[model samples]
Target: MIRAYAAHEPGGKLEPFEYEPGSLGDEEVDIKVEYCGICHSDLSMLKNDWGMTQYPFVPGHEVVGVVEAVGSKVKNLQIGQKVGLGWYSRSCMTCEFCMSGNHNLCQDAEGTIVGRYGGFAEKVRAHQGWVIPLPEGVNPVTAGPLFCGGITVFNPIVQFNIKPTDQVGVIGIGGLGHMALGFLRAWGCEITAFSTSPDKEAEAKALGATHFVNSRDPEALKALTNSFDVILSTVNADLDWPTYIKLLRPQGRLHLVGVIPNPLSVPIFPMILGQKSVSASPLGSPTTIAQMLNFAGRHHLEPIVEFFPLEQVNEALERLQSNKARYRIILKMDH
Candidate 1:
């Protein structure tokens, strides 16, 4: 039996719940969850905003825990080993993408909280492959968000072979953008933050942004025409697509990690003339996640997190929903 907090209905409060998970599989491992980060996606699932959430939903994916048990076929992991799990809990290992080390792109990937329970609990289970071991210098208390939000921003850096010399701009500066600033700054890029909040400017610079642009300022944005090598949009809110497109240098990319609800109305002429591109990616593969963890550890990069007890999870969710989280929120499980 595992103890957890679950929502019984859409937009419902999470309440105490328990379940018996019978017969753990050979390739699987049972994780005794220590801390779980509350991502915006978790709140979205809780509210059924995506219309894919299941009731009795246990919403957590940014998980840090220990291996309490491993199946017969599981190797490279042992009891009491500390590890973390991200948005994806499983991927069919036989796919070409998986074989090529792109497990996150696997067609039959399973989300930790989509069809089953997740880490808003005392214990969770997942295939050994998706359970990443923490690097030596990383703090367990603050590492949870790296599994989801961290990777969402970090994967692009790996996939695109982003250069330290590149002039990069990050949008939103909330959960995802803040982390992106840290990573890009450590990566040696000339970092610029595009945010509407004047109050966040100082903090953005503190987080590694060398320059701050009030995204609402037309003059501020207009001055930067064809200036950036890459602009990573981390906000879910819609923006002036053509304006941002024009900000890119030739061959530049506007990559999106945010889950915007509406269709993007882009001005194709600017992209065509500049030979620019727009792209997006999902959460990263296990291999990429491991690399990201190592990079984070080496650079002493970690998410700025606000802590909440598991019992106060509903409040934590509310905080995230209200955009009141400092950067990221984590639920510390009780022993």
Candidate 2:
């Protein structure tokens, strides 16, 4: 076991300090983490917003690192291979969902946040099957957020089968929405940004939004009935489901991905009447995650990011909460 520095929530909040190295089981691969990114989910967990967090918690899921050691039985990875891990740490592989390639839906799909430790530490032991090979040209620090934020956006884009002829609306332009726009653009779809702020219009266009619609504009929203083929809702706040439903075309979908902290009112007319599909994914499956990474790499696509030192994790997270971070804020482990 090697000593690792991490920010842990001893009880009330996360504070940076040294954490004792823990033993690794033979089924795990010990990773020397180079970088980890602050995700909104981390904030949710640390604040007991999720009600599943354990004390002395280390909050991070978007991890990129090099394999330091692997069990003899590990056949797929080698020492020093660059790899990445995400929100999910482990899942019961014997479950029906795991066998069916829908591991995200597994009854025991545990997170890197909940069941085990996460990536804010200088080192982490990850399940071999959960580790993904990083594309050569992408730096590990840059690759970290792709594991969570990137996949969160990419899964819905591909799942919805969005095409060039389709109009796609991306709600909220903070972290996930920003990446979603890039994915949609690479897929050659016409994208519209539905944001509450007028100032975000320029930034939205820069991120590949062809059209910007102020969500506050009643007339503009009224004119969009049956306009979009799919809308990926990335906002964490309660959405205007009634207005958004009108923007969908018959057979179009309003795919919800973001998690709201409170109850939301859903308008039944959105899909019940038109036979439209309304769905959301927990995260991408392993196959889908691999495909999304390769697609991003091949397209030279990178999510916009700002770097924060490991000690400044709280500040970084605050930026994410205040919607100041352009897309993501990656934390580097100062080894």
Candidate 3:
């Protein structure tokens, strides 16, 4: 049996647990997890915050590891290779969505958090299709967040083709927000950060945000009306739809990758009046994920992460829920 950290119920009452490490399937690879990032989704599931989670769940999706073994049917991967996995575990590749390279939206898509045990443990077994090899010289601990939060923002940015000199705004300065600012700056875009907290101005600017707007300030909001060429919301809180929507330039798209549980409230008049559109992404396709990883490697883009021992998974979750981590928090397996 492989050792894992598990929450038997809500609120992340996690403890060291064991489970059967059944033999790998024909197309599977068993990875010895090196580092795993703690995401808010993990906390949500642990607490049943979203109310759709299955119990006895081990919450982790941003997984980075080394291949420990591979099934006979596996190809394009080898033992000892560095590999990483994100939210998606499996999807029906034959479906229209999957066929169009949008596997992240496949109706039959199985998540790493739900159907399969995730990376908050010593080992993770994955289908070969969902695993991607890491480039040499990248630290697995820092690489872990790239699997989820990094990719969440990067995918939408790439999908919308936000280019150099393009006016972009990142709405939030949390984990995903910091990553978004870093990626936008690396891509040579002109970036503005939208936040309600004035205390984040210095930190946001340090992450390459060219401007900062206090979203709660009427004057600041007015100054930005119709200003952004592209804006992506990284905050998981509700937004003043008309306010943020009006900030988009004509034909500009607003992409959302965050989970704002409440229904979006936006006036049709503003969207129609501004000629704006709304879009979102689940995470990213494997192809795009690989490209993002390469880009992060080339640009030296990475999140500032706090490290914790594997046994400290519960502590890490508490910090993540409390917004205490500087940007990212990761648990290192003691392999």
Candidate 4:
């Protein structure tokens, strides 16, 4: 039996719950969750924002844990290895996308919290493929966000082949955006952080932004027209789409990693004229995740995190819901 905290209804407080998981699959591994990160997606699911959450939901996908059990066929992991699991729990290994190493694009990919109990528990189970081993020099406590937020931003840098010499812009210096600044800086790009909050300029620079732009200021945005090679937007809020498009250089791209609810109202004429592109992507494949972890380890990059005991999950949720967390929030399990 796995003991966990669960919500019986939307916006309900998480309470103690327990259930016996059936026998593990031949390819599954059971993780003894040590730390789990609370993402905005968790809150959205808690409120049924996307309308797919099930009751008694245990919301945690950014998981850093020890492998407590492994199925017989699991060859790459041992019972005591440290690992992390992200938004995805598994993907159909035989899909064309999966076969081609784009498992995150697999149509049959399984979300950790979509319809199953997640890592906000004593133990969580997932197929071996999604259980990423933590590399040396990476701090597990602050590593949780890398699996989701970090990878979300990093995947685009790889997909678009962002050049080290390119000028990059990151919009919204929050969870995902903050990390993007760091990754883009390490990738050798000249980074500009665009944020409505001018007060965050110093902190954004400290996080690897070479310049800061007040996104709320029209003149400030207009000054950078046709200057950026790539702009990565990490805010979920809709903004002046046409203005951002105009800021891109010819053949440049404006990429989104945030979950913006509304359909984008982009001006096609400017994009067609400049050959610029607008695109978005989910998290990366496991192989890409491994590469990200290694890069993070080498660079000593980690999220700015606040820790809360697992027992005080409600309070932590409130902190995130209130948008008061400095950055990421991690729940430390008292085993």
The lDDT-based order of candidates, best leading, equals 4, 1, 3, 2
Per-residue C-alpha lDDT of model 3 across residues 273-302, encoded as one tens digit per residue: 767898887898888889898998888888
lDDT of each: 0.95, 0.82, 0.86, 0.95
lDDT score for residue 131 of model 4: 99
| Candidate 3 global lDDT | 0.86
Where model 4 places Cα greater than 4 Å from the true spot, the runs are none
How many residue pairs clash (N, CA or C atoms closer than 3 angstroms) in each of the candidate models, in the order given? Answer: 0, 0, 0, 0
**How high is each candidate's TM-score?**
0.99, 0.94, 0.97, 0.99
Where is model 3 more than 4 Å wrong at Cα?
Answer: none
Tens-digit lDDT string for candidate 4 (1-335): 99999999999999999988899999999999999999999999988999999988999999999999999999999999999999999999998999999999999999999999998999999999999999998999899999999999999999999999999999999989998998999999999999999999999999999999999999999999999999999999999989999999999999998888899999899999999999999999999999999999999999999999999999999999998988999999999
Question: Per-residue CA lDDT of candidate 2, range 1-335, in tens?
Answer: 44433334532445655555566667778888888888889888877687888766777888998999887778888999999999887778788889988887888877987855678788887778788888756666688888998999898776667778888999988889988888888889999999989998998998999999999899988988889889899988887787787788889888888997577566776578877777777788887888988888888778788998877776777788787887799988888
Q: Which is the better candidate, 2 or 3, if ranked by TM-score?
A: 3
For each candidate in turn, give its C-alpha RMSD to the true structure in angstroms: 0.6, 1.9, 1.3, 0.7
